[model samples]
Target: MRKNTVGTAVTLCAAALLTAGLGTASAAPATSPAAAHGAQAQRQPRQPVLVDCAFQPQARPDAFILACGDGNSRLASLHWQHWDGRTAVARGVNLVNDCKPYCAAGKFHSYPVVVRLAHPEPWKKRPQVRQFTQLSLTFTGARPAGYDRVVTLPLWS
Candidate 1:
């Protein structure tokens, strides 16, 4: 009778441990649904803000630099020829650094470029006059051998 009582107590202890482990396992999945929704929210891309091209005439607004704040890429040395309510035509140099090994230790290259900004799409979010929908760039004269003549980039709000 004494041996039977000891065995029964060991069995009860093992059963209690297994029950506690299953309780913790089930609780982990209960929080997973909320975590999944939070991950989905993070996957959405934030809209890009519109920056004004109009700078002071003395400031030499030659280039429309699309730095995007990171300083990785930009348009350099732009001389605006015409800018109306609908279109802007400019001649500039597109300075891009090929960040091969790393960004800080990259070599900057200059290419002669003719940039045109047009296609005014209304920003439903801002509804402003200066906002635009597209920007087109044409590398003229002597660009790198295999580069495209025209590249259209979307400007979205």
Candidate 2:
């Protein structure tokens, strides 16, 4: 009976401290369901991006230039199908210059292709940003003459 009385008194005192918000905070209180969900959403990983030649991170970009020096090669009318941390897939038109006689007089040619961006790594300029480092184009039907069916290129960071 004495032991029961002491335990009961301790329990009552602890309960009173908690009720008055004076209890030790070593143990965190249970979180609400909404708060837990919000925390999960916040913890979700951010999607990777494509960095342009000017060193800018872009998400779901409609167009990306392959040749930054002369701007002779580029992709346009991009329709992105997938974008994630590992890879990104898109269907677009690869506009390349013929450079038949000279680049100064070169004419742009459009070829249908399926584009894939992979090999994501942190950007050198901005370590916090991850960007696609490789680009691949698979010609759907007709491809540029002297060009293979599939071509892979290193993207500029």
Candidate 3:
């Protein structure tokens, strides 16, 4: 019985390898722009060169936006910036109840689209710069208030 099992395992392994090789050999050429760049060979997704801002309710900052996917909302501050020279800003308004429909908070609200803003210029700390470059929002309210998360556009890596 043991020998039979071993033989079966070897056969399975050989079949798997053969199938893999054949699959690759028979596959058509990549047609996407990414494929043209030979990136498919490495099996990596094209990372967007833009900043993303959202609130994480589990990581902390109970009422604010957090960077990484944590539940807490307080730490929900502007955490990352991309190469698109865009940063995100919170709508600035806080929801009276996290349960409100479209509220930044939702039931199981595991993933709520928080506030995000982007600036075209490199994110530079200057007390004088005003007017954001580009703005996109997934927020609870229209008025930017106390619990919103806002960040400057990323000019750096």
Candidate order by lDDT, decreasing, is: 2, 1, 3
Candidate 2 local lDDT, residue 148: 96
lDDT of 1 by residue, 1-157 (tens): 9999999999999999999999989877555778887875454212222343332111225545555655655687778787665776778888776676787897777888887777755555544334456778798865544557887888645
Candidate 3 on 1-157: residue-level lDDT in tens? 9999999999999999999999998896758896666855333222222322431111112244333244433223333333222343332332233444643554432223344544444323332222234434454334333434433322222
For model 2, the stretches where C-alpha displacement exceeds 4 angstroms are: 1-45
For every model shown, what is its TM-score relative to the native structure? 0.54, 0.70, 0.23
For this target, which candidate reaches the highest lDDT against the unseen true structure? 2
Tell me the deviation in Å of residue 28 in model 1: 69
Instruction: Rank candidates by TM-score, best first.
Output: 2, 1, 3
Name the weakest run of 10 consecutive residues (lDDT summed) in model 1: 51-60
Task: Report the C-alpha lDDT of model 2 over 1-157, residue by residue, as the tens digit.
Answer: 9999999999999999887675446556788899998886554336777888787778888998888999998999999999999999999999999998999898999999999999998878766667889999999988888989999998877
Between candidates 2 and 3, the lDDT winner = 2
Q: lDDT for model 3, on a 0 to 1 scale?
A: 0.39
Q: Cα deviation in Å at residue 85, candidate 2?
A: 0.9
Clashes of each: 1, 0, 33
